[model samples]
Target: MLMERYMRVSQAYDKQVYTEDGIYLGKVEEALIQDNSRIYGWQVRLENPKIKEALRGKGIIVPHTLVRAIGDIMIIARVSIKKEE
Candidate 1:
């Protein structure tokens, strides 16, 4: 089942993530997609309001590929900006 497969992929990933956590952080400015490899993940751009509000001034970019499923809820791979670039 496609849905099942997607669920598995999503469940395998998608976890809680925080920026600096100590101060006002930023928002997702942009996303850098990693297409060279088949892995799932992306690099997020942190700037402006996104940065000001970000705990770490680091935005999160979830790869569309990692998003194995998007049904009642949007699902994605458990990825981190630290692990992206």
Candidate 2:
């Protein structure tokens, strides 16, 4: 489940990001916030072997909608994140 209240954007930095399936993707590099001050997405540095191999060093952008929960770590929908070329 999602958090019950708001969170400071700075708190997300360095938080480990992982897939719901438990694949360690990377750490939080930045958070994309809209002009309205809402978190729109997350910019995660590539770290996982498989995901990095396919993504080719490019950072991962996970939309807020794909985020299942937020707290100690970030969990995203892996299937959709692996948008292979």
lDDT of 2 by residue, 18-69 (tens): 8899989888888888997688888888878877887786677888889987
Which residue window of length 10 is worst by lDDT in model 1? 17-26
Estimated TM-score per prediction? 0.29, 0.82
Worst 10-residue lDDT window for candidate 2 reads 76-85
Residue 56, candidate 2: C-alpha displacement in angstroms: 0.9
- What ranges in model 1 sit over 4 Å off? 1-55, 80-85
Off by over 4 Å in 2: 1-4, 82-85
Q: Predicted candidate 1: what Cα RMSD to the true structure?
A: 8.4
